[model samples]
Target: MGEGGKRKSRQEDAPAPPSHRILTADELGLLKVSEVPAGDKWEETAAKQRWGAPDKAQGITRLQVHCPDWSSDRCLVAAARTSGRVTLHAGSDGGDLGSFRAAPPASTSGRSDTSTNAVQALRFARPEGSQQLLIATATLGGHVSVHRCPVEAALSTALAGRVVQTWEEAARLQTIGDLQAMDVSSSGRYVAVGGEGHQLKVWDLEAAGGAAAAAAAGADGSTPKAGEPLFAGKAGKPSRSGLQDLAHVTALAFVPGQDDKQVLVGTAKHKLWLYDTRAGRKPQAELVWGEGRITTLQPQPDGSRIWVGNGRGHVEALDLRAAPAKLSMGHALKGVAGSIRALALHPSEPLIASVSLDRHLRVHHAIKRGSLAKLYLKQALTGVAWLPPLPPAPADGAREEEEEEEEEEQARAAAEEADGDAEEEEEQQQHNGRGARGKGKHAGRGKADGGSKPPAKKQDSKRRKQ
Candidate 1:
C-alpha cells in the first residue's frame, strides 16, 4: 500500500486502552480492616474502655479524630467542648497535638466568659509546593483561626508545636449569616467561606494583611467595601427560608488538580453546585445529590467519582462518567442518627473514614463494591480527614515505549543505507560490463541475462532486509 494509505489503516486499527480499573481491596493488595493499626478492633477496645464502663455515658456529643491521607506523615485532631476549651489530640494513641481556648465574642449579649462555642468545622489545606496549614471554625461566635503546625520531628506530640497565628470573625449577621460550614482550597492560597449568608466568599490568604483585618471589618457593621469575589456567578435570590433559600452551602471541597480554579459546594437542600473561581457569577453546573439534603460531598483524586453523604445516614458513590448517572449505595452505618459530620477517603487505600452523631468514628472499605466493614471508634466521631497521599510514581511503561521507538528508527535508517549501497554496486557493474558486451556478437543474449541479474539481486537484497 502507499505510505499515506498504510498510515490511515493503522490509525483506524489502533486500540484504545481503559484509563482506570475497578479493583476490590483484596485484588489491590489492601489488607482487611482488622489487620491495620487503628483498625476497628482498636476502636472497639477504646469504645469499651470509655463507654463500656457504668459511669460513662453511651452517647457522645462530640468526637475529634484525624485520618491523614496515606500521603501524610502525621495527623492532628482537636475537639471543642461545652466549657470553651479546645482539647487537641495528636494520634489515635492519645498523643497530644495541642489545646487552646477560644473566648466568646464580646459583642453578643450573653455571658461571654461562660458561654462555649462548638467547633463546626476543621480542615488542613494542601496547597501545591507548600507545607500544610491547619484551620478551625467555631459555630456560635463566628470565630475562624489559622495555625502553624510544627513538623512531626520538632515536637513530641502532634499538638505540641501548634502556634496560633490569627483569629477573626468571618462575616456580619446582616450580610453573611452564621458560619455553618467551611473549607480550604487545595492551593492553600484561598479559603472558600460559606455559611448562613446567601453568598460564598473566597479568602485570599496571601492578601497584604491576614484574615483578621477582613474579619474585623466584617464583624463591625461598617459596610466594608466589596473586594473582588472568589466566584462571580449571579447571586441566588433569598427566600423566606432565610439561608436555606439562598446558597445554603453545607459542604465545600476544592477540585483535585494542579489548576485550583474549580470548587464543588453542597447545599442543605440537596443541590450540588460547581463554581469556577474565575467566572465569579452563577454556578457552572447545578445538580441534585438525591431527594434529601446533601450533608457531605467529596470528589475523588481522579475527579471521576464523587462520594456523597445524605441525611439518611447512607453514602452514595457517584459514577461521573456513566450515562444517566450510575449511583451505588456505599456503606450504611446503623447508629448515624444525626447528620454525617465528616467523610474522608484514604489517600492511597480504599478505606473510607466517616464520623457521625452516633458517637462512633467508623472506617469503611470498598465503598464502591458491596463489602462494608467498620473501623469502630467509641466516641461520637465528629470529624475525620486523611492525610493527602504521596505523589504518584513515574510510569515505567511510558519510558519503555519511548525507548522502543528510538530503536525502531535506528533500524529503519540502517536498512535504507544498505539498500542505497546495493543499488550503487549494481549500477557500477552494469557500467563496467556495458562496452565489452556491446562489442561482442553475443551482445543480445548478454543484455537479456544482464537485465535479469540486476533485478534478481535487488529482489534478494530486499528480502534479506525484510
Candidate 2:
C-alpha cells in the first residue's frame, strides 16, 4: 500500500461508530428494553411483604437469564435481592415463576435464620452433562453454595400456575465472603470469586465433586480443608496485585477462548491486569485507565477487545492487540449520574446492554456507538446478563415424520440465505460503498464541488468591470 493508501487503511480500521441510533426494538427482541416490564409489582411486593417492609437491605441487585436450550426463543430470568432472596421470572415478558433460597444449615437452634443473611452474588450456569442448571449463590461474610435447578419441573409448575421451588444445596464451598464479585468461566469448569479481601480465589468445578457434595449434606456447611484454591493472589508474585495494605478485586472475567487460560482482572486503583493461570501467578500485562477504580470488565465476543466500566461513569475500550494495551475509545453511559453498574453484550449481535446507578437500562447499538434505547426502570440497577436462544422442542405425535422433512428443508434454506447475506456484507465492506472519498485525478470531479471554484475569479471580474 502507498502512503495515502496506508493512511486511509488506518482510518478505516477504526472508523468511528456512526453517531445515530440506526436499529430499533422491532429489529431484535433483545434490544427491546423499552418494553421490559417496569418490575413495579416486584417493587410493591418487596415494599409491602418482602425485605422493603423490614428494612433488611434493598431491592434486587443482580439479574441473570437462561434459555435451557439455545434453539428456543424464550428464557428464564432470575433476579437476586440484597436481602437474600432469589426469584425466578420466566418468558419474554417477566412473569413470576418461583422463589428459591439455600436451606439454612441444619440445627441452628433457631439462632440464625434467613433474615440474618444477605445474598452477596448470584449467577446461573449449566454444568456439562447430566446436570441441567446450576444456581451459584454467595452471601456476605459466608460460604458459597451451588443449587441444582429442576428447570423442566419448575417450568411445568410455572405453566401449571404460580409456584415456588425450595432449592437444596447441590454443592458447597467453605470460602467466606463479603464476596463482592463472582464470575463463572465459559467452559463452566471454574468459578472465580473475590472482593474486599487479600486473595482472589479460583475454584475448580470438578473439585466440587464427592467431598463437597458430602459436605453439603452436613450441618453448618463444610469449609474446604486448609481453604486452598487453584490460584490465589500470593505475595512474592510477579505482579503488584499483592496487598501490603487493603485492596479489592472489583472486576473479573475469563478471557474468551476454548483454552480459557487467561483471566482479566480490574482493581480499585484503575488498573487492568491480565493473568495466565497456565503460566505462573504473575500478571502478563497490566494497563491503567485513569478514571476512578475499574468496576466492570467485559471481554468482547471476539477476543480482540475488552470493554471496561470505571467508577467515574465512563466506558472505555482497550485494544488487546497492542503490546501494552492502549485505550482506543471512551464514552459515558447515557443518563448516568453515578458509576456504571454492569455491561452485558449480546451473544451474537453487535449490541451491549448496560445498567447504571441512575436507574436506567441502556442498550448500546455498537454500530452507532450510541444508545438504541434507554428505559427508566426506577430501581437501583446493579448487574445484567443476556440470555441466549432456547433449545428446540422435540418433535412428536403423528406429524413427526412430515415435520422432520420440513425442518431439514428449512435448515438448508436458512444456511444458503445466510451465506448469501455474508457475501453481500463482505462486498459492501470491500468497496466502501457509501461516502467514499474519490481519489486521484477524479477526486473533485463531482456534481457539486461547492468549495473548489478558482479563488481569484471574483477579483478578476471586478477588475474587468473597473
Candidate 3:
C-alpha cells in the first residue's frame, strides 16, 4: 500500500480518546499540590476556555456540585456568575459543559448591574427517585426559582434546562431583605433563605407537595403559605442605644444529619446562631464566631464538625459536639490575602477547597497541616465546590450483563448433559431386563422338550381320572 493508505489504516486501528469527567478523591491525591500556577495561566486555560466568558470580570457569585448519588462517579459543577448566568463545567478537566441565563437580562461587559436579577445563591439537589438534578437559585431581587437539569445537559448548548417552578417574595426591595443566601437540605425537602432584613425563613418543599407538584402549580408556583414559615427567626441582638439592629444574615447552611431541623446561621454582626425547628422559633444557641462577617459554613456529613470561612480571610473549624461549639485553634487555616468567599469539602477525603476575594482557589488538608493545591484566577472568586466523580460508563453495564448471560448459558448446558446421561442409563437397564426374560423363556422351552413338562401333564390327567 502507498504511504497515505497505510496512515489511514493506522488511524482507523487506533483506540479512541478517553472521555473526561470529574476527578475522584483518589485521583486528586495523585497531583502535585504545592506547585501553584501563575494567574495569567488561568486566564488562558480554565477561565476563558471552561467558563466561556473571560470578559465576565464581575466573577462568579456562587458555585455548587451536583452528584446523582454519593456513589456515582459522574458529577457536574455549576457556577452562577455575576452576569446573571449559570455555567456548567466538567468535574474531571474543568471543561465547559454548558450554560444558561438564570436571572434577568444583563450585559457581559464586566459591570455589575444592581437593577438586574443577579443570582446571589444557588444549590444543587436531587429529590427522591429523581433522575435529574434540581438547581434552586435566589436572586438579589427577591426572586426564587427551581430549574431542572437533565442528565444529558452536558452535551447540549448554552441553554441546557428550564425552570420548573418559581415564586416571588412580596416584600419591597427597599424595606425587606433581599435573598442573599440560600440552602437546600440533603433530602431536598427543605429550603431556607435569609438576608438583609435580618429575616430567616425555611420552606418545606415536601409539605408544599414537593418539586413535582410545584411544577404543576403554574409559573407563579406556591409560596410558603401566607407568611407561615416552617421555621423563622430574625438574627441580631437588641442594642442599648434604642436603635434598630442592622444585622443581616450573610450565610446559611442546614445541619447534615439533623432531619432538616437544625440550621447554622451567620450574620453581618460577626455572630453564629444554631436553630432547631422542632424546638421553637428562637435560636437554640448563639456564639460570637468571628471578627468579621461570616461568608460560608460547611458542615461535616455527621454534623459533628463545621468548617467556617469569614471576611477576615480565615477558615476555622468548630466542634458542634461541644457545649457551646467553640472554634478550635489547632484547626484554623490561614494565608489568604482577601476575604474567604466560599468553602467546599471533599465528599470522602480530608481535602477542603476554598475560593476568596484574593482571586485564588486553594485546597488544604482539613487538619491544617498541609496545603493540597492552589491556583490563581485573575478576577475575584465568590464561590468554590469540589465536584463528585462521574458515574459508571455504559460499556461497564453492558459487560456485566454479558457475564451474567454467559454464566446462565453454562448452567443450562450442564443441566442438559446430566439429563442426557440419566436417559441413556435408564434405556440400558430396560434392554438388560428384556434380554434376561427372553433367556428364561428359552430355558423353560428346553426343559419341556427334555420331558419334564410331560411328567407334570401326566400327573394332572391321573388326578382328574381319579
**Candidate 3 local Cα displacement, residue 406, angstroms:** 32
The TM-score, computed over Cα atoms with residue i paired to residue i, of candidate 2 is: 0.62
Q: Write the per-residue lDDT of candidate 1 for residues 1-466, one digit (tens) a residue.
A: 9755654555555433221111111111111112222323323322211211221211212333344432222544454554444555433233444455443444356545333254455555544554444444444444445444433331233333544323223322211346666666666566666675545666555551343456465655342332564454344434556643655667766676626776767777777667777765666666665566777766788866677787767676655443123333333434444556667676667766665656445555644433343444433344455433222333454444456568879898988998899999989989878867767758777787788788889999999999
lDDT order, best first, reads: 3, 2, 1
By lDDT, the best candidate is 3
Question: lDDT: which is higher, 1 or 3?
Answer: 3
lDDT (0-100) at residue 237 of candidate 1? 38
Evaluated at residue 61, the lDDT of candidate 3 is 65
lDDT of 2 by residue, 167-190 (tens): 656666656456667777766667
lDDT of predicted model 1:
0.50
Report how far residue 314 has shifted in candidate 1, in Å: 2.3
Total residue pair clashes for candidate 2: 10
Best by TM-score: 2
Instruction: For residues 203-267, write the lDDT of model 3, one tens digit per residue.
Output: 76655444435444568533333235677886545567867457588888988777888888888
Clashing pairs in 3: 21-92, 22-91, 22-92, 73-389, 73-390, 73-391, 74-389, 74-390, 74-391
Which 10 consecutive positions of candidate 2 have the poorest summed lDDT? 20-29
Off by over 4 Å in 3: 1-51, 57-59, 68-73, 93-101, 104-116, 149-176, 206-227, 236-244, 323-330, 387-466
How do all models score by TM-score?
Answer: 0.55, 0.62, 0.61
